[model samples]
Target: ALVYVVAGAGVLAGSGWWPTAALVAAAGGLALKAIWFDPWLSVGVLLDVGVIVAVACTWPASVY
Candidate 1:
């Protein structure tokens, strides 16, 4: 939740290490969800994947 929010903020501001942070957070969230929360698959998984994709795609090249 916190990671999602921070990533969102990072995407919006395009500052700091938000994009990378978002990617890491989204991956971690997906793993944790799969391992514990929604092991059977759910909308949460889809959302996590979406966040990861969006962050990766929109990540500024300058940041790298």
Candidate 2:
């Protein structure tokens, strides 16, 4: 369901690096979408962007 590529275990442990992992995963997702270029994935693109923005906005408290 929710993507946790780089932060699976970190997320489970509530680690501070989880946000960084999420940013990495979201960036990866956007790259994949660009490479594959599927109209069906438009909504996913928006979500990926959202993750990137949200993590960046909260960076101070997220990835310590």
Candidate 2 residue lDDT tens string, 14-36: 78788878888898889999999
Model 1 weakest lDDT span, ten residues long:
55-64
Q: Give the TM-score of candidate 1.
A: 0.66
| Per-candidate clashes, comma-separated | 0, 0
Query: For model 2, which pairs clash?
Result: none
Local accuracy of candidate 1 as per-residue lDDT tens digits, 9-41: 876786778877777887997888867875566
RMSD to truth, every model: 3.6, 3.2
TM-score of every candidate relative to the true structure: 0.66, 0.75
Model 2 misplaced regions, further than 4 Å: 1-9, 59-64
lDDT of each: 0.75, 0.79
